[model samples]
Each structure stands twice: as structure tokens, then as C-alpha cells.
Target: MPFLIVNTTVTFVALLSFRLLVKRMYALVSNSKQESYNVLIVGVNDDSIALAEALSTSKNQNFNLAGFISFRKDHQRIKILGKPIIKYGSKFYDRIAPMKITGIIIAGAQLSITQKNELVDKALANNLKIFSVPEITQWTDKEDVTSKIKEIQIEDLLERDAIHLDDSEISNYLKNRIVLITGGAGSIGSEIVRQVSSYQPECILILDQAESPLYDLELELKEKFPDVHYEVILGDVRCRERILNVFKNHDISVVFHAAAYKHVPMIEKNPKEAVAVNIMGTVNLADLSTQFNIDRFVMVSTDKAVNPTNVMGASKRAAEMYVQALQQNDNVSTKFITTRFGNVLGSNGSVIPYFKKQIENGGPVTVTHQDIIRYFMTIPEACQLVLQAGTMGNGGEIFVFDMGKPVRIMDLAERMIKLSGFQPYQDIDIKIIGLRPGEKLYEELLSDNSTTLPTHHKKIMIAKDKPLDYNIVCIHMEDISNAADSENDSFIVSKIKQLVPEFISKNSVFELLDKKINL
Candidate 1:
């Protein structure tokens, strides 16, 4: 009877101490809430719960969790670590407004683009700050999860669903292979380099004439991918001797040829340079690849190459033809593949940067044409598609990415203005400038005569075009190359038109050539 009493007394004292500690911790948390920023998290799934727990313990004491905003209907009404899920959908406005919520945290990748836009617009209206979780693929551990929360950008608003890639297939093709990227410093080429580096290639030879960008890329690779062997060659693709030397020195088996002059108006102004670089430069590379018995040669082409109406597009189309013709050579060993894609957002010389500059100048944002519609994909997405296309190609296949519905320039301008926290036309004026030379109303991924063949991946398709006579293509290419050497603009334009019969000029000086041919 005495032993039992003693045990009961000890248990009672321990329980009393634990209760006191719990009360003390709750009081401290309640006190902190008064000074902290109240945050309501979006989504109620496992990721959201994990994010809330991470934020609660973060060193940055600014964020205080208020509750949850249910994104998943099934997970609704459930408490996340004892925090109430007070509101969802339209009901959130009343509850959130009353809670004195200062910020919103979109905590999971389950939120759709439409949903995000609605929520973000509402948050902006309420004058509340907004942050979104990183992509689930990017998350690995509990540490640093809060650091991934960032202020959303216009690009984020326009992002499509994450692309699921065939990692095994890509690894098999790229592993231990000596790869070469021609324009390695440019936006698209640089992204290609970054993604390809992760696959453990034997070595990557970055060949570009630009020194500063190449240097920057080398430094970045050194920091991020120290184990990957890479060589930065300061050389232009136009130089046959320089390219030949590099190929001779390195055991280059796979080549991603991304070098070319891409600006349409600039190429229109200097047709000879466009021909020399886009066409002949490609010829130089293709010829060398064939000579070297390269395992795979993937040329990056543009959507403008379809029924081309400008110097840049015609030049790219001509390059495509030359590369395609090379496959017909009975003695050729290289499998030449061309991957055509639309404009990549954030690429140098793209309209997004130009519009951003115009917006920053605090005046009118210029649009080439109000109705002009073009397809757009993020730089990383386009490069991944390029790599995937390279893996899927058997020989001489032109792969076109399935860029979703075309977006109007006017709509894009308005959205960008709104994303910048300004009202379109009220805060910032939009001016519709006439189409520049070589500009088009719309872009085409395939020509009128071409048809698409479905691939294993839904986002990519094969464009089967009419077969070109290799001998004839060679003759025209030779003439164009000779004309380029002569630096005769009219002669080069004439030869390109003759070479690509579909090369019709638009708002350009070469339009007269089209009229003359028609007459």
C-alpha cells in the first residue's frame, strides 16, 4: 500500500511539470504571433503540410501560419497540425480579409494556372504579398524549403504543365558520348549545355565566338557541375578551318548545332550575312559531321522556316534542306536531325526583353502588330524538347514541338502590364507599330505540303516534307555560297528565293523579287 502511493505521487508530479511546459510553449507562440506576419497557406495536401511545418520552425521568424486554404477537396476540413482550414475558393475573401492576413503562400504544385491567376489577382487587389512553393521536382528535403518561396514573375503566370522526360533514354544516348554545342553561350544553347551536363557526358565542347558569355558559362559549370569535363572553344561556325581543327582534335560523336543569325529584321537588312551564317555555316558543319562519321547531328531550326517569307527563315529553310539532302549521300555516316521550335521566352533579341525595356522606360509598349500571334515556350522547355528530339530521331527527321495555342501580342502586352502592377492603357499605353520587315501575322510549324507524324511523346511530332533532290540542292547552295562571298545582297536574295521556292518576302525590300518572279 505504501509503494503504490509513492508511485502515484511521482506520476502526478511529472504530469504537472509536462502541463506547465506545454502552457509556457503555447504562450510564447501566441506572443510571437502578435509581431509576426500572418500567412495563410494554399493547399491541404502532404506538401502543403510539410511546407507549413518548415516555415513554422524557420530561422526567419517573420512568417506565422494562420491556417490553410484547401486546394484539394478531399483534404478539406482537415486540421494541419491543429491549424484550422477556414476558407477556400470565393469564400476565402471574407475570411482572409477579416483575419488581417498580410501574405499568402501557395504551398503546392497542385494549383492550376487559372487558379493561380485568380488567387494572385485577388491578392493584389487586397494589397497582400504573394509567394509560391517551388516545383515539387525541385524539392528534396525539409531544409531550405522556405527559401524556395519566391515572388512570382510574369513567366510563372504563363508556365504550362511540367514536362515528364524519358530520363533513361536520354541517359543512354548522352552517357560517355563526346558532345558539341555550337552556339553554347546563347540562351538556348546555354540551357542545352546545363541540361546535357546532368546526364554525365564524357565531355562537352562549347564552341562560340562570344568570349564574355562563354566565360560566364564556364564559371557557372565549374561551380555547379565540377565533375563534368567541358571545353570552351572561342570559334565561329563560319570558319571551316577552325571547326575542322576542333573536330579533328576531339572525338566528337554527338553534335547539337545551334549556331545561326536569328533576328528577322536584321537578317533582312543584311541578306548576305544571313546566307553566309545560317546557310553556309550550317553547310560547313554538316559537311564536317558527315566527313567525321558523327553518330548524331541535331540542327536547331526555327518555326519561321516553314513557308518562309524572310531572309532569316529562308536561310534556315535552306539550311534544313542542305542538312536533309546530306542524308541521301550513299557514303555519308552521320544521321542529321533538325528540331524546329517557336520563340523561346527570355532569349536574347526576343520581344519579351524588348517589351520589358519599353515598359521600364515608363511609356508606350510597342507592338509590331495587334493581331500578330506567335507561339512561345520557356527556354528550358524548348531545350529539353530538343534533347528529347535528338534521342528519338532515326535519320533525317524534322521534329516540330507542339507549342500550345498561339497568344496574341496585344493580350500578351496587357497581361505583362498587369503583371507589372499597372493597368494597361491607364497606367501604361500600348502603341501598335506597323509590322517590321520580315514580320508575319502568324507562324507555322509545318508547310502546306507537309504532314505531321505522331511520336511517342505527345508534345513532339515529325514533319514529313517533300523529298529534295540532293544534287539540285547542292547546286543552289553552291551558288548561294558564291553569292555570299561576293557580298552582293540582290544576288544572294535571288539565289535564296530560287533555292526555297516558298520564300516569299513580306514588308521587305526583297518583296519586289517575289513580284518579278510572279510576273
Candidate 2:
């Protein structure tokens, strides 16, 4: 009887307090001299209605309910809480202008960034502020919707619609399966780990040479997924013994090979290490995967590997050829898959972080060339596509991602400046530094003669390139490996040229090899 009475008392007190708070808020808004800005709520869903109620009762009294706008063609409701609900159309601005709508609040997260951007652009042109409510999953009982509202970010401007995936297909393949991710601490690799974890893998072995990043990743995965078993192995991919031990210890069914030296200029200077890691290291994993009879081996490739001009690009091309040839072996059981994409936004080595750092220092943001361009994908999006493609690959097929349109580096700098609330070349200067060694004006997803076949997924395609003999490719790789070990730069480049005839050097010492070959 006492427990029931206490519960009733608590419930009554909570309701009484809320009523008093609402009454006090109404009084505060009535007495305030500041004018309430007329606002239009986007969407007429439950989230929109809830947000409207919260805004109406908020103590800030900054927004006044003007009306609701519906994107749906069949939304028949004419009014919500006495405010007129209007359908969005070509005359959207014409309808809202009469009401003097000063702000627009996007109510739900169902709208794509492209759609939101269109709305945001129109609102900005008309001198109206724009805000978006957080997704339902992000909401908490203690926090109000108004508090979760925020201005759109630059990433929103670049985002595309979410990629569709066969969750059941992916889950079935991964459930209770032991998986291994090389370089699992890096940007792309870490995201792959996160995405794969959700599929309920039996165990995940994270192998990376970087101690700090590996430890951090371990801590994060442990905290985020306490139920999923994870083991962090701090070792280089070049160490065959260590990798073999990892494979021997765990019955890894799937392997994501993402470990490679990717920095163009740095790798150009140290081609020997690039050859050893990107080429020889990949060879190590492929050989072991085949020997161990692993089910799948997915290699993370790059757009640079297409008609490559840089040492890093050529090395990756050599690895791709080796892996492709491995599938031709009659004795091999593993299905080798390769995913090729361009620059990932906000990666540790990407220009986005470099520009951000330069901007934070209050000075010039350096661009390699005014005309240089590159395709970009978000880290998560790229990793998700990698998983999707990995599941869909048959064998010996290179999956090239459709990275939308190429973005000019100069325009990117300007966008970054504007997003930071600064005028380009006025408040922040974007200096054009000359291109570095081995750097190109643009990146290619496929070579001149290469063609792509469409897949079930719209965003991914299979690149059809002439197959090279496994034995011949292995012979060239062996020579390249020996040259790399001997630190013979000329021989290494020569062997790479033999393996990838399209490997032309640009603005570097290896350019002499191309001239000599022509002679």
C-alpha cells in the first residue's frame, strides 16, 4: 500500500510540475518584448508535430508557428494545431513569402541531403534561416527537440542518398564467421570494422602496425560492442611470420586487405618501401589466404591504380594484378575481390584535414594545383560499398565505385572557406602550390581501354581488364621484390614497368625510364 502511494505521488508531482512549467513559459513569452520570428515547419509527420509543440512551449520564445509544408503529394491534412498545412511545390516560395516566414525547420531525417540542399539554397536566397532536427535515434528524454536542432554542415552539401544494401545477404555471410581486417585502425579500415561488427561476426582480428591507433581502436570497439569478441594484433603486413601466426591461431573465413603506404609524394621518394609493403605485403596475405583455404579475400585498391603515374599507384597496380592472377590458380579455393575507389573525405592523409589544420591556424590553405581534381567518397560510404561489393564478388573481378563527378581542388577550397564563414581569397587565401612529384592533374577509375560491366548494385561496377598469366606476373613480382630488398631503384622501376606497361612516371626521376623505353 505504501509503495503504490509513493508511485502515485511521484506521477502526480511530475504532471503538476510540467503544467506549472508550461504556464510559466507562456507568461514569460507574453511579457517578452522581442518579436517571435515566423517559422515554417518542413514535413507533417509525428516528429514534426512533436517539434512544433516543443517550440511552442519553449522558454526562448524565438520561433512563432507560421505553417507546415508537406513534401508528400497525397498529404490531405489541411491544418495542424490550427496552423495551415501547405503542400510544397514550384510555388513554395510564393506561398511562404506572404506569411513572412523568417525560418525553416526541417522536422524529420527522411529527406536526402540533395533535397535539403535545394530547400536550404532557396531559403538562403530569400534571407531565411534554416535548421534541422536530429534523428529520432539521437534524441533523449532529457533533451528537447529545439536543443537538438542545428545548422546544416558542409558534409551535408556533398552527401548523396544512402546506398541500399542487402542486409540479410550480408548478415548471413558474416554471422558467426571469423573475420580479419589489416590496418583496421586507419580511417577506411576502422569504418570497415565498425560496419562488419553489426553483422554479428564470431570474432574480429584487428591487425595494424601502429600501436597507438590499434590501442585506440581496441578501446573504442570494446566500449561500443562489448558482446563482440575482438583481438588487436600489432604487426606489420610485411611480417609474414606474424600474419601466418594470426591466421594459424584463428580460423579466419574472411580477410579485408587494406594495409598499404598511400601517400603519393612520400611513397615516390621511398618507392622501395612502397614496393615492399603494397606489393610484397599483399602477396604475403594472398599466398597465406590461398594456402589456408580462406573463403574470401577482399583487397582495398585505389583509383590511382588505373593507368598509374606514381610509385604508390604502380605498386598497388602490381598488387591488383597478382591478386587477380591468384584466382586463376586451379588449386586455390579463396575468391579474391578488389574494390577501387578514389580519395575518401576526412581521412588522415586527405587534403580535407590538411586544409582544416591550415584554416585553424588562420592562414593560407594550400592547393597542389588550381586545375587538379579528384573524386571523393565519405569513409563510411566507401567502407559500406566495400562490404556490399565483397559480398557480391565472384572472383578475379575489380569493383570500381562510381564516385560521382570530379571536384576541382580550387572549388573545394572555396567551399571550405565559405563553410567556415569566411570569404575566399578575401578573409582566407588559397595559395596554389606547384604539383608534387608523381602527382597528376586528375585520377581515373578505369584505364583508357578498360570497360566496366554493371552489377546488381547501381553504384558499383566490375572492371574488365585483360588477364595476365599468374606465373608471368609472379616472375615480375619476384624480380621487383628482390630489387626492392636490394634497394636498387632502377631495377625496381624497371620490373614495375614490365609488370604494368602503363606505369609512366610524371615529374620524377623515374620519368627517365619512360624516355629510355621510347628510345
Candidate 3:
């Protein structure tokens, strides 16, 4: 009887305290001469409704609910909480002054940078502060985001539209399966591990040679997902014996191959390492996946593999060919898939983080060329699409991601500087360094002989590339392996050129090899 009374008293006291708090907040709003912000919420939907309620009932905050701005085309004159919700149009500026709106809150709406910038600029002209409700990108679709509000961010402008995923399909594809992630300590690989862990996979085996990053991942996975089972093995993809042993011991249902050297200039200087890792390492994994009878093998490829001017691109192209040829063999049961995309933002050694560090250190940010442009995707966004594409693939498919429009490096630098509250060329100077070896002005998603077929996901497409004979491709693969064993730069470049005839060198010593071949 005493325990029941105590529980009942506690519940009653909590309700009583909330009622008193609301009463006090109402009195403060009524009497205080301080300017209260009549905020306009953006995009009226399920998420916005919750935000409106929170704002209405907030205490110790000088906020008054005005109305919502409909960024969607299907705008309706709906009344939310006795406030008028209006559509944003040419007359929006007129309505804003009448409504006495002091601020704008974008509630989980996906607007392009152009559209958002226009709105923010117009609101700023009218003296309105902009805030946004952040969304949860990974783990779950839970949007418990109405509790807090934050000022706008740089990612809010640069990141692409909010992607809608089929969660049920993703769960079915990953649940209870032993997923093996090669290079699980890297940006893309580590994100795959996190996303995969959320789906309750049977076991997550992370294979990476890097000790520090792998150990850090182990700590994060254990702390964030204590229930999820995972094991980390310090192993390199170049070692066939180590990878073979992993496949032999674990019943790995799926594989995400992300291990490879990727820096173009470094790989250009040392093409032998690129051959050994990007080419030979991929060969080891592809051959072992076939031998182990793994269900799905997803290889992370690059947009550089399209036209292939550099040895890095050429090496990755050779690996792509080896797997596609292996997939063409009638006897192989493993479904081989390759996802090709351009630079991932905020990835290790990517220009954005490098620029951020340089900006913090006080002046001169370096751009290779003023005209240089490349596609950008966030690390999490790329991994989400990878999981989605992995579920959608059957066999022998190179999935091309729709990476929106290419962004100029110069523009990116200026915007980043401005976003950091500094004037470009005044507070910070961006130096135009000459293009390095193996660097290109722009990146292409498709080669001349390939076309894309649309998939269920609008952001992903299947490339119907030129056909290759399995026997001939395998013969060149062996020859490249032998040339790599010889450790001769000319020998490696010669064999790679034979395998990928489109491999023309640019701004490098290897261009001489191309000239000799042309002569």
C-alpha cells in the first residue's frame, strides 16, 4: 500500500509541476516587454507537427508560434494549432511582415542549395534568423529531433537531398548474416560496419591492416552497440593467405571489399604498390570469394576507372575487369558487384578536411587547378547507397551512383571560407597549385562504351558496360601479376596498358610509355 501511494504521488507531482511551469511561461510572455520571436516553421508534415507542439509548450524561451512555410509544391491552406499555415510564393515577403515573424525553422525539409539560399537570403533581408531540425542519418529512422534547435550548418547547404530508403528491404538483406567488411577502419568501410551492426547481423568481422583505427572502431562498436557481436582481425587484403583463412573460417554471407591505395599522385609515383594492392589485392579477394562460395561480394570502385588516365585508375580498372570476367564464368555462384563514385566529402585525406585544417592554421588553402571539378558525396550517404545497391544487385553489375552535379574546387574553397565567417582572398587566400601527376580536370561516371539502366533507387543505376571475354581477361590478369612480381615500373605499366588499352598517361613519366606505344 505504501509503495502504491508513493508511485501515485510522484506521478501527480510531475503533472502538477508541468502545469505550473506552463502557467508561469504564459505569464512571462504576457508581461515581459522583451521582443519575443514569432517563428515560422518550414515544411508542414508529421515531423513539423511535433516541432510545432514543442515550440508551443516551451518554457523559459521567448518564442511565439507564427505559421509554417510550405516548400513542397503540394501546398495546402491547412491550419495547424489554430495558426495559419501558408504556401511560400512571390507574396511570401508580403505575408512575412504581416505575420510579424522573427525567425524561420526548416523542419527536416530537403531543399537544394540554390532554393535554400534564396529563402535564407530573403529571410535575412527581412531580419529573420534561420534554424534547422537535424535528422538522424544512420542506425534507425527515428526522428527524435524536436527537442533541440540549432543554427544552420555548412553541410546543410552542400549535402544533397534527404534520401528515402526502404528500411524493410535493407533489414532483410542484412539481418542475421555474417557480414565481412574489408578495410573496416577506413571512412567508407567503418560506416558500413556501423550501419550493418544496427540491423542485427549475426556477426560482423572487420578486416583491416591499420592497428590504431581498427582498435578505435572496436571501442566505438562495443560502446555504441554492446549487444551486437563483432570481431576485428588485423589483416591486409594483399595477403592471399590471410584473406583465404578468414573466408575459410567464417561463414561470411556478404563481403564489402574497400581495401586499396587511392591517392593518385602517390600511386602515380609508386605504381608498383598500386598494382600490388589495387590489382593483386582485389584478385585475391575475388578469387577467394568464388572459392568460399560467398553469397555477395561488393567491391568499392572509383569514377577514375571510367576513362583511366592514371595508373591508379588503370589499376582499379584492371581489378574491375578481373571480377566482371570472373562473374561471367558460368560455374561461379557468387554475385559480384562494383559501386563507382567520385570523391567522398570528409573522408581521410579528402580535400574538404584538408582545407578545414589549412583554414584553421590561418591563410593559404591550395587548389590544384582553378578549373578542376569533381563529384562529392558524404561518407554516410555513400555507404547507405552501397548497402541499398548491394541488396539490388544480382551479378556482374557495376552500379553507378547519381552524384548530382560536379562542384568546382575553387567555389568549394570560397564557400567554405565564407561559411567559416571569413572573407575569401581577404582573410584567407587560396593558392592555385599546378595540377599534380595523374590528376584530371573533371571526373566522368561512365565510359564511352557503357550506358546506365535505372534501378528502383533513383540515386543508383546499373551500368551495361562493354563485354569482355573471360579467358582473355584472366590471361591478362596473370600477366599483370607476373609483371608485378618483377617489380619493374615499365613492366607493370606495360602489362596494365595491355589489359586496359584505354590507359593513357597524363602529366607523368608513364606518358613516355604511351608515346612509345603510339609510335
Note the clash tally of each candidate: 0, 0, 0
lDDT agreement with native, every candidate? 0.87, 0.87, 0.85
Query: Which residue pairs clash within candidate 1?
Result: none
Tell me the TM-score of model 1: 0.88
CA RMSD of all predictions: 9.0, 6.3, 7.2
**lDDT, residue 412, model 1:** 85
lDDT by residue (tens digit), candidate 2, 1-519: 999999999999999999999998888867586545789888887788888888878756668889888887666367788898878889888977789887888876767777887887667656677777875667787875666877555556665667888888788778899999998999989999999999999998999999999999999998999999998999999989999999999999999999999999999889899987999999999999999999999999999999999999999999999999989989998999999999999888898888878887876999989899989889998999999888886789999998987889898888776555566788899898899999999999999989999999999999998779999998898889888877778778888998999999998899999999999
Clashes of 1: 0
TM-scores for all predictions? 0.88, 0.84, 0.79
Cα error of candidate 2 at position 178, Å? 0.5
Better of 2 and 3 by lDDT: 2
lDDT of 2: 0.87
Candidate 3: list runs displaced more than 4 Å: 1-107, 110-114, 120-131, 135-151
Candidates by TM-score, descending order: 1, 2, 3
